[model samples]
Target: MATVKTVTTADAAAKLDELLWVVLWQPLGLPRDIRHTLSLEGEEFELLAQENGQVVGGLVAVWTGGTEIELRHLAVASHAQGHGIGRSLVTEFYRIAKTKNCERIHTIARNTSGEFFRMLGFQTAPGQAPEHPIFREHGISFELMERFVEQGTPADCSTAARSRGG
Candidate 1:
């Protein structure tokens, strides 16, 4: 099983940036600095999934509106997909949100990834997603998705609240 850990130091953040570029951006022909350009303007943090100390997946999220968090990016290496690494990262994200007293989590999910977010309990939020010509040209789209954070104790970090298969 992969272990999910927070990205605290510059090196960890750099690793996550690289992972995001390779898994989520590079294939789309996005610029190398795309991550920096799209980074949220508020309080943000990153989480990484590691197997045998190698990063294989990562997520970037930011606190929004004082009571909400927005998942800005999520990516698992092509070679590591379908192995629950993404799930583990999301589960840990839920735990951190609960500890921070966030009431909900939101994400602008790509059309290709909407089903994955749905499987993790995110519902299509009632709003129009921002338009991006590059994505549209690539046959990709976006949607606003959100999920309420269930009330839980600060110490609760288990997957019970957001595990697959209910």
Candidate 2:
């Protein structure tokens, strides 16, 4: 059985860095400039999946202000990819996001993951505009997908609501 745990302290950060960043992202050209950005943030969390004490997969998210959590990284062992590990990671992140009172979560998924995120009920932004944080970054231009905790509060709606009394 696999157990999932939240990364909360420096020790957890070490484990996470070993499994997720060094082992995975570095091989895929995620850019070294983003390494400092990946360091533990005051509002971020790492969800780790371990079986019999050996880490298998991870998902990292950071609260991006005003009740939104942004997925920084997510991956399952290449050998573990087909066994629902990815889905479980996202679901767990959603559970954590709700617990943290975040009204929504977002991620800038690579083209390869378009279908994966779609299966999890994430929708791509309908415009070419760089409205999402992930897009405003200096080195990437991936599709941004967002999942909302409340049905009617679309990304644009949240901005609109702030100008009203609702």
**Candidate lDDT values, in order:** 0.85, 0.69
User: For candidate 2, lDDT tens digit of each residue in 1-166?
Assistant: 6677888778767776777765455665576546566554547678988767777788888888879888878877766676767777777777667666788788877666767777776777654624435533534346888877654333333233233432
Determine which window of 10 residues in candidate 1 has minimal summed lDDT. 153-162
* Model 1 regions more than 4 Å off: 153-166
Residue 36 lDDT, candidate 2, scale 0-100:
68
TM-score of each: 0.90, 0.72
List where candidate 2 sits over 4 angstroms from the true fold.
Answer: 29-33, 37-42, 126-141, 151-166
Best by TM-score: 1
Measured by lDDT, the strongest candidate is 1
lDDT per residue for candidate 1 within 33-74, as digits (tens), equals 998889777899899898988989999999878998999999
